[model samples]
Target: MLRLCAASVRLRLGLGLHPSRVSWQRQLGTHGRKESREPLNSPKRAKEFIYRLQAGERSCLLQELQNFESIAIAQETVEPSPPTAAQIKYVLFHNTLPFIGFGFLDNAIMISAGTQIELSIGITLGISTMAAAALGNLVSDLAGLGLAGYVEALASRLGMQVPELTPKQVDMWQTRLSAHTGKAIGVVIGCILGMFPLFFISDDEDKKAKTDKAKPC
Candidate 1:
């Protein structure tokens, strides 16, 4: 009876060791299978990994930008010989053509109207004969004069050379006017000016040289 009771006591002690406790110890053990260790998802380690990845990306982006800048600089340096005198003249003529053409058109409209309108009628309306015609001419003249100054200032501010006004400013002005009026007023002015290119001649030697260069030699 005594031996049977001792065997029963040993069996109870073995069963008291839970299977769940054994599995937990095995899962968490670093070496020995006794104590269960806590989970090892440290906040510091996660933060460090994120920082390293961000730094790597930043470094790659900076290097790529620097390489692109170097390539652009090298390409610019390799090009030799500035544009010829003729090319420069063409550029200037193209640039200033719109403004000059607008001036001529404005004059023509005034002259044509003055020839037709009664002088006393203008005076009785409390407006000068010239002043009344000018109101009708404002849109065309303002676009040419005001827009030219604005474009020049914008180009200077942006650190870019203003292109020939014909190709650049005229196109830009026309685009702006078309957006506002859906009509190509700037384009019409450009065509008129282009038709009368001979009228743009200047007495200045430099101006003459540029004009001659722009002309077919």
Candidate 2:
């Protein structure tokens, strides 16, 4: 019995000394790779990779912008010469937006009466008034343009640098500038004078309000 028991004890000791099959498989999943030495996904490495990617993106953007600048420079070299006399005239008086706006202001001043008719004058009277204003504006513009030409001619005779625009286009531009300036000033003056009626209206409104308030309680 003692000999058999000693054999069984030796077998148990051998089994304990040796690793179990299932436990070894569970613990050594990577098989040959050393554990805890190098990480597959380290935070430091990931941050560095992201930083490199951002740097690459920035570099590409800079390159694209540089290319665009070069293209713009090339296009500029191919374009017409920069602003001079005509361009100066264009900027000062004949710019697309300002020219349209100034002319509209002139027309609006002449048409203000028809626009400000508060009473229901009916459609026909309103249309007639608007037509009269339009016709009047046309006549005024023609006279102003003629005067501008005459003045420009006189200015030339007076030995001014006005002849620098002897070129037909420039002369026409000068004439236009003169006419538009005269018209705009005349309209503004007319509009100011027309405000006289507004003063009377306000006075009448005040008197009416006072009478209403003073009525017997």
**TM-scores for all predictions:** 0.27, 0.21
Tens-place lDDT per residue, model 1, 138-185, is 433433334433432332344323232222232343433332231123
lDDT of 1 at 153: 33
Q: What is the per-residue lDDT of model 2 for residues 48-122, given as tens digits with 9 covering 90 to 100?
A: 433533344445434544755676566554533434555454333322222232233334433444334322232
Give all candidates' CA lDDT scores: 0.36, 0.36
**Candidate 1, backbone clash total:** 4
Q: Which stretches of candidate 2 lie over 4 Å from their true place?
A: 1-171, 203-217
Alpha carbon deviation, residue 129, candidate 1 (Å): 3.8
* Residue 133 shift from truth in candidate 1, angstroms: 5.1
Where does candidate 1 stray beyond 4 Å? 1-74, 96-100, 114-123, 139-217
